[model samples]
Target: MSSSTATTAPPATTPTTITSPSPSSSSQQPKPKTKLKLKIRRAVAPADVAATTALINAAFRADDTTDVYLGAEHERISLATEESVLGSMTATDIAVFVGVVSKAAAVDYEGEELEHKEEEEEEIVGHFWLQKKSDTLAWLALLAVSVKGQGQGWGSQLVAHAEQVARDEWKAQRLEFDVVNTRSTLRRWYEKRGFVPTGRAKPFAYELHPDWEGVLRADLEFLYYGKDL
Candidate 1:
């Protein structure tokens, strides 16, 4: 199936807890604080194709124990290659956004860098594609976040950024996407972000991939979800 036809499952939501330090533990050493920054921007072809493709495949890898089955041996339900990413980048109606994460450096009072600086590190942790479907409608697809990046609200950030671009840049009045019907968790995640089911669905186009001979559930279908901008 084309990446546009499906979306990767959303990151699992985890609750946050806060605790106060006890007076008896005042002697404990303070741990170093590290802050991470996320930047979401339109991807550039060739330069971002490989990294974007790898991140998508890594994030979309299927879990046989939980995901709707494709086969025991197949680790991924959808895969993206450099060529495929480049193709999307070149499409006039499509725009791809990538989320990059890096450790934020602290500045001294004099506006100079700290001597104990951490090495410059960055990673492409998440990505999604937006396609202009009509003058007032756009489609979101291929949303994925790496395993390490999950549970940190990065996926939500990507979705929010995409919606802004769709509305401000594309002049779209609505945005929509399809999720596998079996993925109730993923659907609910989107619902929390203001998307609601459109009461529409279509059969998963497994027949399109002749090489995929794995057994699939007979009732698998893509459920439409949408939000008005």
Candidate 2:
């Protein structure tokens, strides 16, 4: 759950625009809006491992613009896999939740729409890990959302869901997580959500992968953030 490449917080949701047709147009057709339905629930083992792995990898590796500015060797890489996801799910203290999204059927749909039913298949768009560190503490980690779902607020929902579970269900007094030191924007996003710096940090666990020695930033560290329930 902890990694220098992990995205601790999600960026703000991008605003969606619904454009209207010009008043002078003969066929004044407005843009059709598709309503997306999101569902969050505990991830089932085996069934969710592959999808969750893909979601995490896609999200963590989505942005690499900083690599060019820093150096080619400073790129972040995601190493999530079905085996690792399944192994994590085996832990009794860790609970993973997945956010699934599907297109809502149109209210005025007719038989013609049935042909596109395949396109309506629900997709696993986001996921997060909530580990019960102790009776009064919980740790949040591995939060991620698919690139397609990034601007839709699914990530925030996942974090909120984790907080509620940790505070109410687990009766935890506080929640905490680690973010890469260089991710100032992400840290600020968490701060806006009531998390603050704990003035503690740990070296990135590069030993997890030998190849990461040269690929990841040599000075990378994880800065802690916490919130009281």
Instruction: Give TM per candidate.
Output: 0.74, 0.74
Find the candidate with the highest TM-score and give its number: 2
Writing each residue's lDDT as its tens digit, candidate 2 over 1-229 gives 3322332322111000001101111222132244344588888756788888887776655544452114533566655767667755666667888888653432222313334556675668778778787899998877776665444556678778989999999999999987777666666667888999999977666575576666655666777889999
Off by over 4 Å in 2: 1-37, 67-76, 103-120
Which residue pairs come into collision in candidate 1?
none
- Compose the digit string of candidate 1's lDDT tens values, residues 70-132: 554554444566766776776666787888855332121133344454665556777888878
Clashing pairs in 2: none
Candidate 1 lowest-lDDT run of ten = 14-23
lDDT of 1: 0.63
